[model samples]
Target chain A: MSTNVWNGEHRRIHMQEVGTRDGLQAECAFVDTQDKIALVNALSDSGVAKIEVTAFVSPQAIPALRDAEIVMREIERKPGVVYTALVPNVRGAERAIDARADELNLVMSASESHNLANLRMTQAQSFGALKQVASLARASKLPVDISLSCAFGCPMEGDVSEATVLHWSQRLIEEAGARGITLCDTTGMAYPSQVARLTAMFIEHWPHTELTLHFHNTRGMGLANVLAAIDAGANRFDASLGGIGGCPYAPGASGNVCSEEIVHALECMGYDTGVDLAALIAASKRLPALIGHETPSQIVKAGRRLDLHPLPADFAAIRERALQRDAASAEPRG
Target chain B: MSTNVWNGEHRRIHMQEVGTRDGLQAECAFVDTQDKIALVNALSDSGVAKIEVTAFVSPQAIPALRDAEIVMREIERKPGVVYTALVPNVRGAERAIDARADELNLVMSASESHNLANLRMTQAQSFGALKQVASLARASKLPVDISLSCAFGCPMEGDVSEATVLHWSQRLIEEAGARGITLCDTTGMAYPSQVARLTAMFIEHWPHTELTLHFHNTRGMGLANVLAAIDAGANRFDASLGGIGGCPYAPGASGNVCSEEIVHALECMGYDTGVDLAALIAASKRLPALIGHETPSQIVKAGRRLDLHPLPADFAAIRERALQRDAASAEPRG
Candidate 1:
């Protein structure tokens, strides 16, 4: 049995900011293209290393990203910042390439049932489409990352076997020529042990493929799964600011794990994710109004751990006096 | 250098419900004694192994728990359920004993500044008083547990040393004769590394003492810390239903780890906590109105992982039709 150890500095984990696309897409209200650009720019300024700017699906399917081209065009691109776009197929990849996106992300559900329901395609068809997208991206000298959605477990299929996930992952990396694979707890059915087991198996099989984790706080094991993955030697992660973006098909599927929360968790564990939490929270303040609903992120409401609220100067003195009185009264005399 | 291994059937960590005490104490509105009693009875009926019913402190300090004596008396104590009370001093222990509390929980701050600020006494004085209370509890033949608040780190004094926590913990177990020790992330400053180190140290020194963890989600590390503690050999935990409770003095301190969230995390990992999550969520329905604020717990808002909302019968047909359309569009060569 391996024991958990604290070597302090060796505990750092990476965080991916998904606020711009995942967060805004779930909003009931239409965030104007300007506001979307502002939100993306704010997150970029907050020192996030990478931001999932937008998805390139058909405009009719998701009207929220109809201005994806415009928003991508208007945003100020910072040096050293990686801008990624989520593409559903070759058509989406073409738009992303035209928009000059730094990275392209493609996803397909591991469970065949979910894939048909979510993407209007079978698993084989989705993989075929991904291979074409990967070839196109590679031709243009762009990086392509494949995300295996519902890798842990699926809502419709119940428990997903590890062999299924590994089989798809291997096919994607080998045939599609993808650079990295992200295992998503799309329905938040992952337990820590499942995470450790699946992650270990994946790492053992694809020793060279970079692994990232995408989790939902739907069951409140988002961070637990992250820790388990980290322990299994997977470090990269994808999180939405304020935990935005739930699967429209999966009921009770809340957004991706909160970006600020993940950054705070990583930083506290001595991991250098290069994201400023206070700035991230500041960027998240525009979300409630923009999304037309209250956010689910805890740090936005409670403030950061080190955030000190200003108290009345006399408050401490008054409390001290009360303590003194209590001490005197409670002291036993000989 | 230890890697986490996935051993299926690892016993699920036990959860000690503190909703009645810690959850209720932080609310401004006073729940009537009968209502408090009803809540406790409901929790007891829900099959939790232990429930912290109330805290015996001065009414002037915490008026919310003023009717601790009446509430404890009226509870319909279930068989095998350990009813615990949070006692601040010898007088509090006397009252708890009078009320027939199954267990007396003594609290002391691990940080000197927090100890002085919270208890109105130095560490030595608090330890001395705890010894007296332990002696009385032993004479009365009641079980005793010690909770070291701010054991991980403190808001007033950042980065509480591991040596200090272990030293005070040993003192409490040895000198005060505590049957168990609970380390609290009072300000939620504990990272996974810190939790692993402190819990390992405590377990190493006081091998026989039962170690419980009480973590706040203030920094969003509550559940992460719990996983680390579990890996460090801790089995007992203190969680509030719907993640209730906050520290009045600590500005950003908010909500204890949610019971439903923790239960979901454990059960999904194949550990058996023996608590029904749906029933727990049902029991927490009154929490919003009782606290007069919406809780931050995800399970309370989004429901469980497998919880499926009633779907329209047309949903499946609509998805199937969409898939057929896509497949027809793809058949070009024929």
Candidate 2:
């Protein structure tokens, strides 16, 4: 058991900013192409490890992200920051490759019910399509990220077995030759125990696979899950700026965990996320106007813990004030 | 080392509703007496272990809770629920006893700067006053809860040492006979490791005392702090409805953890809080109208995790819709 989660050798925690893709996809209003470029540029400058820039899906299906190609091409990519894109199939992968995306992300659900509801595909069909996309990705010398949606638990199917996730993971690794696998709590049904159990099993089973955990704060346990996963030694995780992403099925739930909150919590607990929270929050200042509403950001409302509030000039003379008030009240004059 | 925080031990968690006192005290507008009565009555019916009905401070100092007596007398006190009140001095204790409060709560700051700013008295003076109040409470046969504010950290004077907290805790126990000691993160500067370390020391040093934790989400770790405290074997906590409270010193900070969110998170993790979340949330629904503002409630926004959304009528036929749409788009438009 990894008893001390933060006290081991220097473990570099990586945060993937997914606001540009996962966050804006759920918005009713379309974020302009120039705004998308600006947002991604700001995130890149915030020293995030990776940024899921956009999704290369059918424009007809998700019109909000129709500018994926332009967003992928127009952004000024930094040297160390890896810009990734979500691709649904070979066609999207083709677009992503053409657009010079650094990484390609593919997703399929572990539960058949969710597979049908979310992607309009069966488990077998999704695997076949992803296999083809994986072949294309391999031929293009691009890395693949397979995000098994509902890896924690499914909304339609209450609990997804670990064996199912492992089986798909094995297929994605061997058959699709994938490099990374993301266990997504698509509907926020994950608890710390469940997260710890799965993370330990994944680490023991697939030692070479780069595992990432995607969480939604639908149940408000997102940061706790992060703590649990880190305790189990899984390094990479997905977070959205301002906590803007949400599971469409779980209406009214928080989108993803707030990037600033997660980074702040980890840094406080002595883990180095290497992301500057002040710069990230300064960038978050533009979100309300762009999104036309307040983002689910707690740090924006409550400044950093060390950011001191202004005290009255007479704070040191408080006893004198009290004594004077008491003396005045004791006098006989009204 | 408690490796498994959630073991087979049948641990019962207790939540104290402080919205009426801690939450409303910060409100710019006064909540009506009838509404206060209705709110406490609703909280009582929801089966919370304790509800801080009001603070018996000077009306001139805090006019928001000036109708403390009326609220206390009017609320339909549920059986098995402890209704507590905050009393700062001998006069406040007398008023609390007159109001028939079950418990009297007194507070002093561990940091002298905070002590001066908040109470207009030195630490020694505050201790003397609280000792007198404690004697009064002992005569009236009422329990006393002494919350050491900034037990974690203070804004003006950063990094409050654990020695300061332990020193005050010992004084409150030996000198004032405090039955309950709350280690308060008065400015939201307490981290999880600090919380765990202090809680363990307190538990080991004072086995007879009931230790409760009070957290502010000023830095977005309020719920995370709850998890840490629970891991350290603490079961009692203070939370407010709708996340209504804020630190007057820490502007734009969240006052208390949202009651429904904490209850919901605990119940999800299989801990029995014994409070009805739906019922508490139902009561929380009226807070917006009473507070004249939107609340920072996640459960209010997201609903319960088990609350399933309405599925599309053509959910099962999603594949067919996609295939048909694909086929139609393949053919050229007329």
TM-score of each: 0.90, 0.91
lDDT of 2 by residue, B1-334 (tens): 2446532134689999998999999898899999999999999999899999999989999999999999887789788999999988899999989989999999999998889888888788789889999999999899999999999888888888988899999999988899999988887888777787788789889988989999887777887788888877788999999889887765665678889988887887677789999899999999999989877787887677666554457885886765676678679998
Look at candidate 2 and give me any clashing residue pairs. Answer: A245-A255, A246-A255, A252-B302, B245-B255, B246-B255
Judge candidate 2 at residue B237 and give its lDDT.
96
Least well predicted 10-residue stretch by lDDT in candidate 2 chain A: A1-10
Model 2 per-residue lDDT tens digits across residues A1-334? 1446533235689999999899989888888899999999999888999999999999998899999999999999998998999999989999999999999999999988789788887787789899999889889999999999989887776788989988998898888888999999888877777787788888888889989999998777788788789888799989999989777765665779889888887877777787888889987878888878888787887766677766668874776876676678679995
Q: Give stretches of model 2 more than 4 Å off.
A: A1-3, A6-10, A32-35, A247-253, A316-319, A322-334, B1-3, B6-9, B249-253, B319-334
Q: Candidate 2 - CAPRI tier?
A: acceptable
- Candidate 2 retains true contacts at a fraction of 0.54
> How does each model score on lDDT?
0.82, 0.86
Each model's DockQ score: 0.42, 0.46
- Model 2: residue A119 alpha-carbon error in angstroms: 1.7
lDDT of 1 by residue, B175-242 (tens): 78999888988877778877877887788888899889999887677878887887787888999987
Residue-level error in angstroms, candidate 1, position B280: 3.0
